[model samples]
Target: MSTIAKEIESTMELNPGIPIKVLQDLIQKKYQVHISLKKIFRAKVLATKKVQSDFTTQYLLLRDYCAELLRSNRDTTVTIEVEREFNPTTESRQFKRIYICYGCLKVGFKQRGGEVLGLDGCFMKGPFPRQILTAVGVYGNNGIYPVAFAIVEAESSSSWTWFLQCLGNDLDLNIRSNFTFLSDRKKGIIPAIKKVYPSIEHRYCPRHIHENMKIKWRSNMFKNMLWKAGGQSVMDYSTMYDMAANGIEGGIPESWVDEVYWLSTWKKVNENTIDPINGKEMWTPSACPTSLLPPEHHTQIGRPKKARKKSVEELSQKINTGGKMTRKGKAVTCQVCKQKGHNKRGCKERGPSTSTQPTSQQQ
Candidate 1:
C-alpha cells in the first residue's frame, strides 16, 4: 500500500469518482502487486476524511456559528431547532431546521422596499440531501436582493409554516402586512402562507407557469413564444412552531463537497470562524445548552442523481453524449474549432474560394 500510496492519492485527486475495480486493476498493472479491494476502499475512505469534515463536526460547529452571527451583526435573526430524544448526557440532539436573516440584508430590503417577495426551495445534493428554502426580495434598482433563507428536512407545509413564522417575527409581517408573495404551486406553501398571513396577496410566477405548461405540452416553439410573450423577473421562507407532526429522522451529510452553487456553499457555513458582517472572530462559549447532532443519513433508493431533471425542450436541443449530462438548452460547441452546432468529432472549417486571375497571361 505504501508503494502505491502516492499513485492512489494522485488518482483520487484527479478523478475521485473512478471505479474501485478500475483502481484495483491499475494498481496491479503499475505496481505488479495485488491488494485486496477492501484495503483499497479503506484507503479511499481515509483520504476523503482528511479533505472534508464529516457530518458530526459540521453539526457541532453550527451552534457556534449561530452565536457568532448574532454577536457580529445586531438584529440579525438566526434560529436553530433540534429534536429532543431520550438519550444520556453524552449524545447530541438531531438537527431539525435553521433560519438565517442577516441584519444588513434585512435592513437593506426594508429600506429599498418592494411589495413583492419571492419564495422558492431547491434540493441540496450530497450523501444526506435536503431541501433549502429561500426568501428573496427585489432591490429598488430591480436586482435580486436576498432577504433570508433556511435549510429544512423537506419542502412541506409544516416546514414552510415554521420558516414563515420566523421571518414574520423578524420583518414584523402580520395578517395585515399586505405584502404580495410570488411563488410556485408547491404542495405546502399555499396553506402555510394562508395560515401565517391570510390577508396578503399571493401571485404565481410566469416562469413556473411555463414550467407547469411544459409538463402537459412539450414544445420548443411554445417555450420560446411563452418567454417572448411574457418576459418576467424572479423569487421567497420561515422557522419553528412544532415538529410533533412531521416524523423525519435526523443527522447530516457524511462528506463535504461542491463549488458550483457559490451561494449554497456560502450559506452552508464555509470553513470560517470569522463573522462576515463585523469582521471579527465568531466565538461561542465553552459550554452551551444546544447540542445539534447532524441529520440522519437516509439512503435513497436507485442511483443518486446530481443534475436536475431537464424539460423536454432542453432534452431536445441537446444530443446525447454517452453517459454525460448535457447543459440545459445550450448549443453544443466544437472543441477543435470552437464553433457551435457540431462537436469535436464532426468539426470542420469552410471558407470562401479565392478567385484565380489569369488576365495577364491571356493578354
Candidate 2:
C-alpha cells in the first residue's frame, strides 16, 4: 500500500495536472491493485508540499551556493543585490536579485570565442517567478559560449542596466571595438546597451524585425527586400534599404534602415591567413604529415617538435573523410493508408461508410 501511494505521489510530482481518475486507472492497470480517488488526492497533496518544501530549502541555501562557486573557481565575479525592509519585530535581511559568472567562462571567452555577443532574457517559471537574462557568444565550432546569467525580480530599465553593467565589467567591454551585439529589442535592452556599450555596434535581430513588420504590412516583397538589404555591404545597404523603405506600399520605419543590421556589420571576422589565436600572419603553405603516429611514439632520435599545431578547421576536414555505415533496414509502408510510419494493423482511417438507404424491414 505504501509503495502504491509512493508511485502515485511521484507521478503527481511530474504532472501536477494529472487527473485523479487517471491515477486510479493507471494503478489498477499497472499494479493490479485498485486505488480509491481519495487516496490519489491525498498523495497529490503530499507531493505538492514536498515540491514546495524543496524550493524553500534551495532558496535558503542560495547564499552558500554563491560562496561555494567563488571558493572553487578563483577570480569568479558574483553580485547579489537584496531588497531589505527593517522590521522592529524581526531584524534580518531579505535576498532579492542574484547574478553569477564563473571565472573559467571569462577566461575561455577571451581565448577562443568570437567577438559578437547576443543578449536575451526569458521569464523563469515556478512558484517564485522572475526573469533570467543571459549573455552568449559563438565559439570556433559555432557553439554557444555562455558568459554570464542573472536573475532579476523584473525586466525594467534598472534591472537591464544592472545586468549589462555586471556583464561589461566581467568581459572588459571598454576596449572591445570589434565586438557586435545581436538581440531582439526588448523593453529596456536598447537603453541599457547604449548606456553600457556606447560605441559598440548594436543590431536588432532580423527575425524580430520581420515579425513586427508582418503585424502592419503583410507584403512578401517587402520581406524579400529586407533580406536582400541585410545581405549587402554598408554602401549597398543604404541603396537597398532606401528602396525598401520608400517603395513599400506602407513605408517601413527609417529606424529599420540602420546600417547595424547590414551584412558587413555581422559578418564573421576573417583570419585571412593570419592565425587569430597566436596573432601571427600565416603565409607559409601547410605541410602534409608524413606519418600518422605521434612524434613521442616515433623511433627517430631527433627533436620531437617540428610542425605547428593544426587549426580546428584543418582537423575537421581530415575527420570528415572517415565515414560511418548507415543503418540497414527494410522499408515500411502501410497497406491500408500507404503511409510510411505505421503498418496496416494500426491504421486510424475508418472503413468505407455504410449505405445511407434504409433496410427493407422499415418499408
Candidate 3:
C-alpha cells in the first residue's frame, strides 16, 4: 500500500474518532503527501457506512463525522433540496377563500376615512392620449400617498364615473362610503364624486383656485384679494358669495363675473390653515389674511389654466429678415395681385387707370 494509505489506516486505528485535521497532519508527516481533511473524512464515512450494516450505528457515526468536519471547515458550502406534497382540492379552496376575505377587508378599510384624490391630463401621442389617471390621497395625517392609478380615453362625466368605480373595485375600496375625492373643477369630477360619496367631504386645492383667479382678474387688485380671502377666518359659502359679488377688493370686473360665480359656488371651503399633525401651513396667496378658517375647511377651484400661448406668427412678422425678401432667387411675385412682372404696389395694371373719358367741352 502507498505510504499515505498506510498512515491513514494507522491514524484511524489509533483514534477511531480522530479529527480530520489530526489525520491530515499524520498522513503528511508519514507519507510526505498532502491531502485535505475534507477528502479524508468523506472517504472514512463512506467506508464505515458500507462495512457497518447496523442502521442506527451507521447513522450515529455519520452524524458525528459530519459535525466534526463542519467544525474544522467552517467555510465549506453544502446544498440541500426540500420536497413537500399537498392535496390539490384542499389547497385551492384555502387560497381562494383567503383572496376573497382580503378583498372584502380592503374595501372596508378604505370606506373608513380613506380619502382619494385623482388627477390626470393628456400626453402628446398615444392611441388614447386622454386616458391617463393618477390617484393619490391626503391621509388624515395630511401626508400625500399614491393609492391607485389608471389610464383611459375621454374625460366625460360618465367616463370619470366608470374610472372611479373601476378603481374602487380593483382596490377593494368601499366605493360607496369610504371615498372623498378632490379633482379639478372639470365637468366630470364633481358629478362622479357625488355619485359615489354624496356625503363625503370633497374639497379642491387652493392653488387651483388662485389660478382661476388670475385668469378672471389680470389686475394686481384681484391678486391681492385672493391673498386676503385665503387668509380669512371664516370662509363659509355666504362669505365667499359676498366676496365674489364684490370682487376680491370690492371692484368686480364685468368680464370676471362668471369666474367669480364659480368661485363662490365651487371653490373649496378651505383656503389656508395649518395641518394639525405636521404643523405645516397650507399654500396660500401672499395677501391671505392672518386669522381664517381652518385648513380642513378650505377647498380649491378648477385647475389653473395653462400659460397663454405666445404668438409666433406675430413675432416673426416683427423680426427683421436682413433686408432680403428671397435669397439667391428672382424677386417674388405679389400674392394679392398674382402678377410676376412687378411688385403689387409698383404694378402698372394695379395703378389707377390712366385713360379717362373726355368731358363734353374737351370733346
Candidate 4:
C-alpha cells in the first residue's frame, strides 16, 4: 500500500493524474498481481479522491514553478501529450473534430473578390510570452473583412513585412489589381507595404490621424475644428483649410495646424490626389475635417460650454415643490409623474374604494 502511494505520488508529480483503470492496469502488468480490475479501480478512485482534498499545496508549488519557467523562457514552445489507458472513442472523436474546427475558424476564408489587404497586430496570452496576434483583412465593396490571423512577436517593420510576405505567398495576392493597403500610422507599416506592393495604395486610417491631432492639441475647440476639416469634401478643402487656418488665427495653436496639415496631406496622398491643399479641385468628404474620424468620431464643431450649477433658489424650489420651470418661466408639476402640479399616485381615474367596516356599530 505504501509502495502504491509512493508510485501514485511520483506519477502525479509528472502528469497530475493517473486514472483508476490505468493504476489497476499498471499494478497487474508490473507486479503480476491477481486482483479484480474493477475492485482495484474503485479502491484507487476513492483513495485519490481523498488525496485531492490536500492536493492544493502540491499543485500550487508545481504551478509556481511552471510560471517561473515560462517567464524565464519567453520564446519557447511546449507541447504535451497524455496517454489514457481506457479511451472513449465517441468523446475522443468529438474532441478531435472540435479541435479541427477551432483551427479552421481561426483561419477564416471567404469569397472576397479583390484582395486589397490590411494587417494589424494585437497582443494575447498563451504558453508563449508576448504573443503578437496579426489579423489579415481585405478591402472590398468599401468595407473590410478580416480573413486570417497569426500569433507573432514584435511589431517591427521587418516583422510586419515578413508577416505580409508570408501571407501573400500563401494567399497569392500578386494578381490583384491596384490593391489598397490601409493601416494606422505605424512607422514600419507604410514602408513595408511600399516595399512589398509598390502599386498598393497605402492609406493611414483617418481615425489614427485624428488621435494624433488630439495629442497635438489639448484644446477641445481645436480638436473639433480638426475633425470638421478632415470630413470636408475635396472641393471644400479650401473652405475647410481656411476654417482650420482661421481657427489657428483665432487662438488655435500653430502645432495643431501643422498636425492637421500633415494628416490632410497623408489623406490626399492615400486618396491619390495631385495636391491635397489645392482644396478646390481635390476636395471630398474624405479630405475634410480630420477630427471626424476616430476613437471619438462625433463632430464637435462648437466650443464646449462650461457646465454651470443651478441657482440655489432654483434647486430649493425643485426640492420643495417637485416642479420645474420651462423656458417661458411657467412652473409645472410632474406629480402624476411627480412632475409640477400633478400627483400620479392620487389620479382620479382609479375607481373609489369599497367600505368593509360596519356603520358606527349600527347606532
On lDDT, the leading prediction is 1
Computed on alpha carbons, the lDDT of every model, listed in order, comes to 0.71, 0.65, 0.46, 0.46
Candidate 4 per-residue lDDT, tens place, 1-363, comes to 545665555454433345667777777788898656666655555555545534433322332333343344342222111223265442221000000011221222222234345566654322122225354553322444444444334456766676666555545556343667667887767787777777668776665676677556656677577668767753433555777676744344333443323444334323421111222233232211111100111222235234444532344452433474334445555444545644455655545767898678665
1-363 per-residue lDDT for model 1 (tens digits): 454444676666545566788888998898798889987887777655442345467777777777777778777898887766776675567887899998777765665445678999986644355689999976433467688899988888999999999988988898889799999998789999999999999988878888889877777778788877666422100111122236433223212222322344333332223346432253754256657777775543347555667865555775767888678667898887888988876756644546696556655
How many pairs in model 2 have backbone atoms within 3 A of each other, for residues 3 or more apart or on separate chains, i.e. clashes? 0
Per candidate, the number of residue pairs that clash is: 17, 0, 19, 34
List runs of model 1 lying over 4 Å from the truth: 1-36, 45-53, 86-91, 228-282, 299-307, 316-363
lDDT of 3 by residue, 258-327 (tens): 3322333222312312212211132222231121111111112335334544432343354446775433
Off by over 4 Å in 4: 1-110, 114-116, 136-144, 175-177, 221-363
lDDT, residue 191, candidate 2:
87
Error of 4 at 144 (Å): 5.5
How much is 257 displaced in model 2, in angstroms? Answer: 26
Model 2 misplacement above 4 A = 1-37, 87-92, 112-114, 174-179, 216-225, 233-363
